[model samples]
Target: MMEIQGIDLSIIWSIIIAFGIMMYVILDGFDLGLGILFPFISDAQERDVMMNTVAPVWDGNETWIVFGAAAMYGAFPLAYSLIFEALYLPLIFVLAGLILRGVAFEFRFKATAEKRHIWDKAFIGGSVLATFFQGVALGTYVSGIPVVDRQFAGGAFDWLAPFPLFCGIGLLLTYALLGSTWLLIKTEGMLESRMRHYSRPLAYLLAWVIVITCGWTAYLQQDIAQRWLHGSHWMLTCAVVVLAVIALYGLQRSLRLRHSHKPFVATLGLVFLGYAGLVISIWPNIVPPSVDLWQAASPTTSQLFALIGTLFILPVILMYTLWGYHVFRGKVQVGDAYH
Candidate 1:
């Protein structure tokens, strides 16, 4: 690998970390959003159709999260140690919920008439639980992951604080908004119309949550707040502004058009922008004030080693993702089966 001021590995590795997390957010995020939209759906047929909307891609979507975590562990051992130690219980719950949702999703179709509701409940419950915990985790990121003496020095339940709780709710609303948009694009008839009707309101709600969370985050970390509110972090602030505009405009356009992919993509752009804001807000600090990307990054040799595999696999993942979506393009008929 090329070396520049001996910082060659750091630059490449930072890109890798950023890319991995972005991939996770963009990929797993929607499926989690799909789960969040679960309760909004009425009628068993509509729920099944909603579930089917994501069935083909949901599992594939979640893979990026695993890829992200694995990349963190491999590239930034220190960050992995700190985050894993601090977020262990919540992570466990998150994994369990995801597992339950994945299994129950498949099993619900095969379940006997008597046990079908059981599976349905499992699916919904699992989705809610998983999404909530993941949101809580996001809040923890904003609140700061606990660290002491270069190691995680906080309780497992530290993630369950009040601010994190609010963040969890915010994430729930955001995911629901995404699911609603996806429904507008993927399904048709009354269900799609209902989903479209729900989109703007849900997006508005999510925007409220975002404002509240930003305020709370600023309150908790005055310095970070100043950085965000002031013109210090101009680029990231610009991203947030752009995201807000896109989200609002896209929602309006989608509402007018009734069903189009642009709004969904715009919603995804909002997600990207939101995540970028968070990352920028916590610059030079991975766990905040305790560790940074450079501090947490592995040695040059290991990073280089991993880059080889990443270079090969990343394209393949992208190709398959695009191909899958391409093949599944157009509205899905409710009578059609997910499997």
Candidate 2:
């Protein structure tokens, strides 16, 4: 394996993939949340304003998913192939939803006033479709995929289960919370107040979902249960639970205090803690219950080559993403046109 000093290149690549996925979830997640929130805001003008808040940077947010997928394909082909094969159905739906959502996002602006509702429905449907399946995919992954002889050995409908379906609901609430907090940052007047009102319930619901999901996950996966319930890892589990509670409390308090930015920041903290906890649970396993990073990794030379290019490209992506957000900073009013 390629090494920089003593660190395995596969490990380095895993971190890179993890970072990309986290960034995608936090960034693209809120935009998807906006689509999920469309049904709640009956006023067409308010919906437009909500969409505008994310218009400037939403497409850029999706780049991380592409980057992560490419990194996984190049750095860990075995795991990539197995995962994709196992998740082909949900992933296909995710892609279809994303395509529909993207099309609706652009076309909604050009659409006639009477016909705009069509696009709105499309947008909402696409967003919910994408987010739900993504959650299902995550839950299915966590529960584990059947693999044998270095290939996927699971049935076509293996992912259809109550736990995965429940996880779909959990992610919808999670993203809705993110969306409301984002609006708290990017809107004002009645809209801001409405978002604040919506955020409180979303936060509470999300907290419950997180707790239930964690418990369900532990019940289904004994290895994960042991990791969190026994040994030194138990301390990490406690820390994660405590930090999640603190973040949830901060989010609720920030909303109550009408601190616009604090609510979003706190939501981000909660999202990060959740992501971190997942990582802690499945450390060293790109494919859970079976494949470790090294076993699933590509050859050393392939990893080294990809790492070199990724190091150069990642910074550019970050720079441009930051610049785009900087230029678009501040409230998106009803009259504003970001598209």
Q: Residues 219-322, candidate 1, lDDT per residue (tens digit)?
A: 89886777776766876687687777777787778687765787788788778778878877887677775687778888777887887898998889889988
- Measured on C-alpha atoms, candidate 2 has an lDDT of 0.92
Query: Mind giving the per-residue lDDT tens digits that candidate 2 earns over 186-264?
Result: 9999999999999999999999999899989989999988878677888888999999899999988888888999999
Which model scores highest in TM-score?
Answer: 2
Q: What is the number of residue pairs that collide in model 2?
A: 0
Predict model 1's lDDT versus the native.
0.78
TM-score of 1: 0.93
| CA error at residue 202 for candidate 2, angstroms | 0.7
